[model samples]
Target: MILAVDVGGTNIRTALIASHGGTVQELRSRVSLGDRGVSENDLIEKLSALFSEIISSHNDISAIGIGFPGFFSAGSGILLSSPNLPQLHNVDLAGRLSEAVSLPVSMQNDALCAAIGEHRFGAGKGHANLLHITLGTGIGGGLILNGVPYTGESGMAMEFGHLRVAGSDLPRSCGCGGSGCVEAYASATAVSAQYFERSGIQTDAGDIYERACKGDKHAKEIIESAGHCLGMAIAQAIKLLDIHTVTISGGFAGAWPLLHPAIIKSLDTELIPPLKGKTTVLRSTLDDTAGLLGAAALIN
Candidate 1:
């Protein structure tokens, strides 16, 4: 068995999987990193405690795989930058964990790991070219070309959310110090922020979705706008890569009903005649475990 860990801003999810493919067990632990004083050592200790618990329960585990968000040296497993987990910047996560656990550890960008898992076992299975877009706190993505995950030189090519696709009317600033990026409009954070900006009500994306489901026009419009921005970005990606298979995942994607129409409409409007209607966009089939399973794929 292999242990797979997906580190997120809000929670850390871990799982045990058969080396071949498939989850055998899973667990979720809320992360407490919002405190300003939290340090890298604190994060490391929390993760170490979780790993120890997993190792104790599963003695047959042979390797460890981690799906970490943000900028990282994939070859060295050294996190270079983490906007969400700022305390972990420059931390050698895989090296430290391997030393503490006495096991081989491999790591990759969380979005890339999700792409691998989706391509191998979920929505993108059997496709030669795939794009996995994650719509969470921020929009992120991974590219699979010719059935292989493609990370550019030094492993930082697929920062799709930072792609500038927003117009002046919706030019919200991003954490990356950019304005008018896709993430500024399409992320869950953006969804809520947009709603609050217009309606003067502050709530999470899920609540906005729930309100939209109950026939709230304002809430529905905000979600559609987000979809339109996301569609614009995806259309650009399709035009550039010529990849037809795209999978959308993340907690916010649960509102697919509201987002799908705008995405498809924008795609139809933007794609060229030969490419129009050729792309196949799908919601992820792996639920929320794609990251975990994808991480496991790295070591397997």
Candidate 2:
């Protein structure tokens, strides 16, 4: 059994997993992660308490793995920079968790973890190459190439949200300080903002979708624009990697009904023949457990 923990910006979920021919056990529990006002120490304490409780029941866990949100040094487990959880900077999360739980600890970015989970048991199953994109509080991505998670020079391989897109203002900055990155237009926050800006509607993506379903032209336009932007970014990725199975996860996947058509349309328009219908975009099959399950796979 492996102890899997997914520490998000505002939530912490834990699961006890037993690998059986690549499928995992599903004893799971979750709790609220602190808001911006929460201190680093508070976050650590909350996680430690949860791990301790779980260890009491699942004492035979072979290892502990965590899916952490932020720019982390894979080798050192040091959180260098995290847009959602700035208080985590310089934190030795793996070291702390290992010490607290008395177990070997492993960690990966949430997107990377989610990708591993999808590749192992979700939508990307049986695919040698896979891409996982999380369009949540911010955009994050992961790539599994040849059945391995390919963290680049510094263990940050698929930071796809940071990639610049066409038809965007160069000076437009993303939450990561980059110019016109995918996150600038593809994230849930971006979608809501666009909806509000385009229509006088002060609503979230859900409301926008509802209105669009009712034939609101402005809502439809906003959805299409976001889909186009997301599609263009994915098209560029395809040009470089030629990955066939791409999975979309997180809050933004809610826009799939509106976004996917545009994404497929844009990709088909850009790709050459023979590769036109090759790539298939999928919605994540895993529910909230995806991240934690993927974290557990680090030890599997």
The candidate that wins on lDDT is 1
On residues 92-201, what C-alpha lDDT tens digit does candidate 2 reach at each position?
87888788878888888888999888888888889999988887868888899999888787666788988777875443567776678878877778777877777766
lDDT for each residue of candidate 1 in 1-300, tens digit (9 for 90 to 100): 999988877677788888888754885554443454567777667777778888888899899998987666756788776767666677788888888888898888999999998998899999999999988998889999998788887678688998888456747888889799989888999999988988899999999999999998889998998888888899899889999899999989988998999899988987889999999889999968888889999984
CA displacement after TM-score superposition, residue 176 of candidate 1 (Å) = 1.6
Q: What is the lDDT of residue 145 in candidate 2?
A: 92
How does residue 135 of candidate 2 score in lDDT? 75
Backbone clash numbers for all candidates listed: 0, 0
The lDDT of each candidate is 0.85, 0.80
Which candidate number maximizes TM-score? 1
TM-score of each: 0.92, 0.88
Error of model 1, residue 241, in angstroms: 0.6
Q: Which stretches in model 1 have alpha-carbon errors above 4 Å? A: 28-42, 85-91
Q: Residue 200 in candidate 1 has what lDDT? A: 92
Q: Which run of 10 residues does model 1 get worst, by summed lDDT?
A: 28-37
